[model samples]
Target: MKKVKPKDIKGHIEYLADDRLLGRMPGTEGYKMAADYVIDKFKSMGIEPAGENGSYLQDVTIRKAVTGNDATFISRDSLGNKSELIHGKDFVIFPNAVEKQTTLEAPLVFAGFGISAPEIGYDDYAGIDATGKVVVVMRGAPDSFTSTVAASSMDIGNILQTAANHGAVGVVMAFTNPTAGVPNISRGVNSVLGPDGGIAVSRYYVSDDVKLFSFISGETLTNFLAKAGLDFNTSLTSLKNATPVSAPLNTTIRASYSSSHEDINSYNVIGKITGSDPLLKNEFVIHSAHLDHVGIGAPVNGDSIYNGAHDNASGVASLLEIARIYSRIDAKPKRTVLIAMVTGEEMGLLGSSYFAKYPTVPKQNIVANINTDMPTIIAPLLSVVALGAEHSTLDKPVANAASYLGLDVEEDPEPEQNRFVRSDQYSFVSQGIPALHIKYGNKTPDGKNNLNEQVQVWREKYYHKPQDSIDGTFDFDAGKTYVQLNFLIGYQVAQNPERPSWNPGDFFETAR
Candidate 1:
């Protein structure tokens, strides 16, 4: 194995995260520069181009929506009293609807957690008839759940689809963990939905036609629950215990929204190393990373650029190093290797979804995907967290890689984040591809910072902020090690004759 140098890794990060790249926003000139750099690197290494049209770039068209100011909502109680709810304060509209302007006047019914799982004998919408009405649900699944059920329930897209299947005209989400009554709406419409072949893409085609969607404030939700003779806290506890209590608040809601959209274009940089074995070359082991980050945002600490140095610039840098290492190897692996630096991942996993739905290579030919999103290397790595590791046959390989590095591989520490559904790996998983999303553990092996306070501090201080750029706090050695782990796992997958497969009877296996 060729040694990867810290300086080489740092150099790549410095260039990609530089302010001159303007945060590498999708479809921007800065992002184009980054794409050009990736393609040039692929060419210089003599890696074969595998993108559409005999090029190293797959075009992903994007649509940007700007919500108009005319959006409004009004609430009416059973006693015939009307109150207007202010937009941006009481609620925020979901922007995925295709219609530019829509209005819905319907009754709102509280649907415990909006989950319908017959396999688990739990259906939140069981006795509730939500047809031609509005359905309100809590943001997350019940706290008490089996690991499998919890994973499925955390997929919000699936939750909304279930609500639509019940014939609900609109869906309202009440965040269990409210952020000061202001829903954390992305400043940009990053949802991978709708038509016109834009930046947003998905593995399964979901209906985005549920036009009336909103997230109400905690206070608003409490008020509604009060009128329905349900204590908010008591009801939440009951739901967590699986004794769901769903009822109508004897209230009606009226909402109107409008938005304007524009077409934008981005690219996914792709290249491959052809295998020597004729038969194995037909199958590919993919190494992927997202290149886009949240572009310029509100000024923070007197700086405007949200340079995603650690958020993902580090990840792309790792892919480049992996590519370099594979290109220099004398004896090529039996199976082909694909390198994809996708775009609009920060937007909504758009680039990867597009690739998954319209793969340049036959989708069946893809064996496995290894993804690196954001790697935090505050201290020397002692542990590795492999998201979705146990769901497939990759656990042994990843554990073996960690063992080779004298590190212990563990499951995700913060499952509440629902990380499995958050990254680019989800795009592949939704399509039945066995994948792993790797990250450096929060604690050291010796138990120093074992609680992962360092990472918590980073999230609070630099995550998605201008301060994420390289600084004294950054550790180059840890970053190099993280990249090595990815190399080890991918190399093993490419060398093995049998393609990685999903665990028998796993939820994802059903996708196949």
Candidate 2:
């Protein structure tokens, strides 16, 4: 396949991430506009509308809810003294309390991390039953600075699900390090127009005075513990004990939060290039990317667009380029190629989750999913970082494509980041589909363990900030490599007789 100028993609990313678009926050006009733009492009490409209703639009049913003005968690001491905390201002909380009222006078159990991993021989819930009580768990991982989870690799989200599964009535997180918790996409205290430069919305529902749980900052909790004359480490350890005395302290939580916005329906743009063989037409090679970004928000450094350039504009751009290449190819593939740009990815991967739950096509026939996200801002195309590379038939194919491009391919620099669960691919993974998420550019040529230069730069800047905009000249050649490689992977998978599956002992292997 011949490579064309990546102008269309470059132009698309710039337009979508533009400040005037107001940070493509889903359920906003700008977000709808972004989706419309993708639909229009799909139509212009002469690709068939592969979404529902014979169109490129797949309704994501985006929604937003503003919680009540104030939330107070009041607790009474045995002496009849009482205190209260405000909502948003004091702390932000998510509630599963579907009803109007919830009362908890039960004992509060301190569960260590609320994690249970037999493979690692650690069980936070071992010998403990938190059934009717509020469970106090530490936020982030137990090994805050050391490891995200086990001596292996895991992140907060992975540990969170485990916590949620343990029937912990309410979770009170003891924040050890605020800085450590900042990387948590769900835990940010202040969010403006995300780096996507669009207004962004919170994933958890909000309601005034609703108290499913309340947060205590690490500093505050630590200070208060010191003031109360409790040995912090001892208390921390005691909380994790299976059997412990309940210390009911007079407590109160208060918070105040507000947002202003217009609501609009969002869409997932879908396009398809049909295959040559009639019998294999139903088969598909899917390329996915999220098109939505955090809409406009509070100013940061006098710039608020948060253009989400690398966060995803880069991804959507790559999707378009791949679509263009496949569409222009003279030799057709045996299976169809589906280009799906999802919305509400920043909102807990909602769009992709909906698609996975209710696919327009047969899920089993999907040969593979190539997720393009945050392609590159670094110049000089070096190598491809294959995340979730451990379990897949796509690995060798990726290697083959890399060889074809004269580029080296290696494992992700930080495999423990759980990049697998960080994007839309996880939705498919949950459905048992084999997927690959590749990050192009800033690759290590020698394949040594040294960090990619761009990665180091990204840690300091351009990561989920308004600075992600594409202003100065950026070499997009690496993006082309990503598209080409994925195109080949898809093309190869289309012709292969065997279906892709997970390797032995991989968590999602049973998803097959």
Candidate 3:
């Protein structure tokens, strides 16, 4: 077996993270160029094409939608008083549908958190019928929500899907304050399945014409609910305590929107190395990474390119190194190895979702997925955090990999981020495939907070910004460590006799 070198990994990152790539936006020329680079590498390494039609590129169509600024939402109370809520100030429409105009006038029903996780005995939509009404929901899961379950189990997707399942005409996200950082929906890419992919709110709801979605600040929501003698804070607290706080408000919401959509195309590059053993070769393990970033957005500090050097270029670089090492192995592992470089991850995991829904290989035969979305190379490696580690047997392999490098394996440090559901691996997990998202652990061996500080600095400054360039700070040595860790995990899984399975009683296992 040939070991990967730090220079080899850095070379991949430097090439993919070049400013000339224009952040490698999905469906754009830069994205295609990046895909071509990966295809070339795979072909040069003699990796067989695993994409569609005997090619290494799987074409995925994406749709971009921009909401009209003139959209309006008016609400009328029982007292016959009406108020016109300005867009972007009072409320912002969710840009998930391809509708020319949408008009929905219905009474408001406050569904606390809008979650329906029966396993946890928390059902905000229970005992309530949202049929033909606009459901007002808080902006997050119940405070009691835990990462022990599937990350998407109680997320906004679940909330919207549940609301749609109950026949709701429209959905409104009520934030506690304007500072809730509600994303501006004026610009976004609509998913082929739904706005945010089919993870939660599938195309079923959109096809049913239940597409009204708006966001309101806490003050706006509180004043609106106050007209009906309801308290937003109290409702939120009750929901966290597993108490239902759904109620009907004597108000009617009339939301109208117009949008325009343009079709776009991207690709996911796939290649495989068939295993030596016939039976085990049929069962494959996937090493995946996203190749797309935020692309070129608003310029910052005289820079216009969001190079995404560390955000995802780091992850893709590691994937290339892993593929290189695998190609050099004299005797391949017992199980086939698949390399997946997905696109449109920055736009709500669209590429990965497409792959998961319609896999190049049979979805069931793919035993496991080990994903590296973003591995911080700004500090010395101390530990590794594996998302979804606890959900399946992959945790053992992950721990073993980390231990091999004298590093400890840990769970997600910030579960509130819902990271497990944020990356490409979750797309596979939703399809009942056990997957883990690998990252450099937050803590260091000395227990000092320096590592965390460096992470924070990167996030605050370069994350999704034009400043994310190859010239920025980086610890290539640290990058090499995590890359080796990922390779080890894939090697162990590929040679193992049995496929990895979700742990008994795990929420995701039960979800499947």
Candidate 4:
């Protein structure tokens, strides 16, 4: 087996994170350049094209929905007094992805966290009748819920679906922070389009029944709750305590919005290494990483380009090195290894979601996915956190791989980050494929083992900022270790006869 080289990893990152790539945003020439770079590398490594039409590229049509100026939100009190809320100040409406124009007038109901999980013994909609009404919710789950459960419950898609299940006409997310402003959708919301032209996957719109999805400023929510004979802080306290305070508000909201959409095309670059065993080769093990980033953004310290060096350039580099490692080996694993450098992850896992749902190969033949995204390789690779591994049989491979690499496997130190659902691996997990993403654990040779603290400091300065360029902190040796560890994990899965399986009664088992 060929060892992953730090110099090769450095080379890939240096080229990908160069300023010319313009942050590798989807639907840009810069993004095409980055994709073509991956294609060339795969070709050089003799990796077979496993994308659509026997090419290295898979089409991912992205629809960008921009809220029009005609958007309006009017609130009416029980006495018929109406007040028009200012857009961008009091609230911001998400553009309707399906409907060009939509209008809804309905009574409002406060649904705590908008979660309805009876299995977990919590249903915010138990007492509230949200039928044909607008449901206002805070973006959170009870503290008693696990991190993955909490993240999935609070997901915008799940929230909208939950509201729709209760026959709610709309969903309005209230800002929890007193100083926080409404979200700005000026750049527009993004969603993927299936071959038939309908929405394949989205974070905002669940169905036409849920016409309105918007966010209100903290002050706006406070005043609205006040008129409903409820205190914002008190209601929040009650909800946080799992008391589930839900009631019909005294105010009615009338909302009208028009959306303008612009569809842009992107690609998910895929390549594969065929396995040796005839039967097992029919099944596949996936390696995935996001190829797109936040693109160019507002200037930070005079640098405008949001070069995603650590954000994902390092991840793509790691995958490429993994491909190279496979290329050098004479013996292949029993199961095919599919390397998928996906797109639109920063926009909400669009590319991976599409591929996981509609894979280039037979979906059932896919056994497992090992995702790499922003490994935060700023420190030594002493230990690892295998996100999502514990939920499935993939945990064994992760543990064995970590042990083989002379690394310890630890529980996630920052579960509050909700990283399991924040990356490409969640797409696979959501599609019922057991997956895991490896991240650096808090361990150091100095015995401090406070790497999480150091990562926090690094994140404060660079996580998504333009400062995350090639010039930022990097331990290329750590990058090499990540590549090796991830490659070994996938290799073991590919070689194993029994495919990776979900743990009994796992949270994601029901998804399958």
Best by TM-score: 4
- Pull out the clashing pairs in model 3: none
Arrange candidates, best TM-score first: 4, 3, 1, 2
lDDT of every predicted structure (CA atoms): 0.80, 0.62, 0.79, 0.91
Candidate 2 lDDT tens digits, 1-512: 46556676678878888877777887777877778877777777777899988888876554343333433455443445554544443344543212333444444555555556544445667777766455555553434323212322233334444445665445566564532221222322221222243323232322222224546555444443443355556665554442232232233322223333333466788899898888887888888999888876567789887778777887888788777787687877778889999887886777776676567788878767878777664565667776655576678778888898887786566645556677887667656788878765345556653546557666467676787787733667656666677778777877776667777655456323
Backbone clash pairs in model 1 (N, Cα, C under 3 Å; residues 3+ apart or in different chains), count:
4
TM-score of 4: 0.95
46-122 per-residue lDDT for model 1 (tens digits): 88899999999888876666567777889999999998988889888866535677788999899988888755567
Scored by lDDT, the top model is 4
| TM-score comparison, 1 vs 4, better candidate | 4
Off by over 4 Å in 1: 77-79, 146-152, 177-180, 184-186, 191-208, 442-451, 510-512
Q: Which stretches of candidate 2 lie over 4 Å from their true place?
A: 66-69, 75-91, 95-105, 119-122, 142-164, 178-213, 219-264, 276-280, 300-302, 414-418, 441-451, 458-461, 510-512
Candidate with better TM-score, 1 vs 2: 1
Residue pairs in candidate 1 whose N, alpha carbon or C atoms collide under 3 angstroms: 61-198, 61-199, 62-198, 62-199
User: Which of 2 and 4 is the better model by TM-score?
Assistant: 4
Cα RMSD of all models vs. native, in order, equals 2.8, 6.2, 2.9, 1.9
Q: TM-scores of the models, in the given order?
A: 0.91, 0.77, 0.93, 0.95
Q: Write the per-residue lDDT of candidate 4 for residues 261-372, one digit (tens) a residue.
A: 8898998999999999989999999999999988898999999999999989999999999999999989988999999999999998999999999999999999999999
Question: How many backbone clashes does every candidate have?
Answer: 4, 38, 0, 0
TM-score of 2: 0.77
